[model samples]
Structure formats: structure tokens, C-alpha cells
Target: MGLTHEFFLLRSESDDEPVEQVVLSDNLVLYIWDSFRWIPAFNPSTKENHVGLNYHGITLIRHEGANLLKDICLSWSSLFSLAPSTLQLTGDFVMDENGNGRYEKLNFTRDDLTKPLTTLAAIADRAFLENYIIVHHGI
Candidate 1:
């Protein structure tokens, strides 16, 4: 089985009744997971409600972290090189029975995922504005 990551927007970190799910492909989430990290100054773990973005947990991005996260999402175009490995990604950890990295096959360029990534960036911008909190539910 493969893993997936889900994103959500919340008015308050404490409020769970209303969370807007940010639609994005699991492939995009998994692709970016390896490089995603906290900005240290944020010291996310020091917060009671925060958690590190991991393969099996939830993570929260607030204020400055939101802005930094936006930057990270926006830079994915050049941050990764999946073009050549899209069709035939070969590696024991990557290749599945189908001969592709679980969902690592990037049949299209980052251009295809740019829109959703941009959308996430926009949501992060909102989080920076204190209008929302970015919640990443990882698989």
C-alpha cells in the first residue's frame, strides 16, 4: 500500500467543526514530504497543538511557518526533478509491483501540479494573515 498526505484550513487550531480540505494529489504530498521541515525558529513542537509533519501524523503551520511553507510549495518547480524518472522510477524503495514508485510516476511535468500547489500556497498565505491555520494530515 502507498501513503497519502492531506491538507486542511481551519479558522482556529482548536476548532475542528469547520475545516476546509485543500484538494491536492497524494502524489504531490508524498513527493514533497522528504524535503519539508520546520524553520527551527518556529519550534513547532514547543506548542501543545503542533506536531512535526511526518509520514504518520498531523502537523500544524501557523503565522511565519505558513509563509515559509508557501515559499516551499511555490519552489517545487525547480526543487525536484521527476521529469526523467516519471515513467520508470527504479529503486527498491520506489518501484512497486507495477514498476513505478507507489505514485511517484510523474507522467506530466510539475506544471500539471503547479495549480494545486499554488492553491496551497495561497491557503498558506491566508494562514499567514491569521485568517486560518494550515493542518497537514500525513499518511
Candidate 2:
């Protein structure tokens, strides 16, 4: 069907703080098919299933107390591009303007996921959490 990935801030394994995880899915085939009324087709020239989509893998940044920040997921096509740095920068701005003056935690919602690329960019831009250890998953 599709791949599902999650990112979250985790406290110590022994700590009691609840992990606030954000989840995203890669369902581009479905999205494009429904949104554009077109289905993916095989490219005889390339000998590949041509959906013309590229997806970002999930990554995590860890901090003291075992806390973590999930990097953003992204996708791109010949006509469109979504970058991790972009999301990271946006997240930094969102935090500066609306976050609680701290980068210790980040939050997002399902509605945010309706636009996964933009949302992940916002999360990655969390500049305050720069010191955390980065963990990559599902590459």
C-alpha cells in the first residue's frame, strides 16, 4: 500500500515524559491518481514504473533526556521540489513566531500532514534544537 513513518520527542527511557510523535505517509501514487485523475504507467524506455515522484526518508535528532525531533519528509518531481533545509528553515521561523520560546519540543497534527513537505520543513527548521544527535530511519 504505502509507507508510514513517525518522528517524535522522546525523554529518557526511564523518564516519564510522554513521547509526542508525528507520523507521515508516502502515498504518492494514490494522491496523484486521485488528484490528477491519472494512474502511474510503465515507461518502456526506462523499463521502470514511472510515477515521477521521489520521497524523503525519515530522520531523527536526539537530545539530552532522550528527547528527539523528527526531521521532515519531502518529495519532488521534475516540475516540483521539496528540500529538507527548506522545512528546517521554516520550522525555525514558526518556532520563533509561535513556539513557546523554546526548541525543547515540537508539535504538529494530521491536518499539518495534509501538506507533508511543508510541515516537515517547518519541523526541521527548529534551530534551537541544533545540538541534538541526528538519527536517520527508513533511508
Candidate 3:
């Protein structure tokens, strides 16, 4: 099976509240491999970097509506170091009865001139996560 990433939105700091979850693209594995370098290898046999252990945190807005999802996308784009002008967000989403949300499709585009390969790759990672959560979680 391919590597898969999961994203979750916690309703509160306490674990009692339900959580929102989604499955992200496996392409994130490749992006992480290309973007970061591992270090201090004792031997070639055991030198592979583990992509599954990597994690990144992004803050979400506290608003109670679709704007929360938009804020998440914007925040994720910023985390990837994407310039505002280069990042474009377009999509539709819906929230379920249980307060879970998913995107019908969240599309993001960036101007090549304004982004480097690493940034572009990271953007893909962020976009995939954002889209996956929006589609599966109902946001």
C-alpha cells in the first residue's frame, strides 16, 4: 500500500468533543523526500529517511462557518511559504449534520514565476491535505 496522510480538526482542546478527519494524497511522501535531507548515516544499508514520522502543524481560525475552511487553506498556503498573489483558492464545500465538513473540490493554482520547486512541492502537499479534508470531512 502507498503512504497516506491524515488530517484532523479537533472541536476542542478536550478529547471529549468529536474530531474531523480525512485522507490526504500519497504524493506527500514524495514531496517530503524531495524537500528534506536526512543526516548522519553510519552505513548505506540503514540510511533511508522515514517519511511517515514527519508532521507539520497549522493553526485554524475559530470561526463557526465556511470561512474556517478558507482560513485553513490560506494558513496552509502561508505555511508553505506561498505568496498571496501566487496562491489562488477556489472551491465549494459542505458541512455534515455531525459538524464534519468536506470539500466538493478545492482547487489551488500558483504562478510558476513566483514559486520555487520546493515551494511548489510543499504547496502540493498542503493543497492535497486541504482538499482531502474538505472533501471527506464536509468542510
Please, what is the TM-score per model? 0.65, 0.29, 0.25
Name the lDDT of candidate 2. Answer: 0.33
lDDT of 3 at 60: 24
**Tens digit per residue, CA lDDT, model 1, 1-139:** 2445777888987788545566565566655655465431122344554324645566777775778777887787444434443333222246657876553334545455666677777788887886677777766
Q: Model 1: what TM-score?
A: 0.65
Specify the poorest-scoring 10-residue window by lDDT in model 1: 84-93
**In candidate 3, what are the lDDT values of residues 1-139, reduced to their tens digit?**
3444444444432333334444443443333333322211111133442322233422222222223333433444456554454443333467889999876442334432223333333433443454321111111
**Candidate of highest lDDT:** 1
Model 2 residue 129 lDDT? 57
All candidates in order of lDDT, best leading: 1, 3, 2
**Over 4 Å off in model 2, which ranges?**
10-20, 28-59, 62-114, 127-139
Residue 53 of model 2: what lDDT?
21
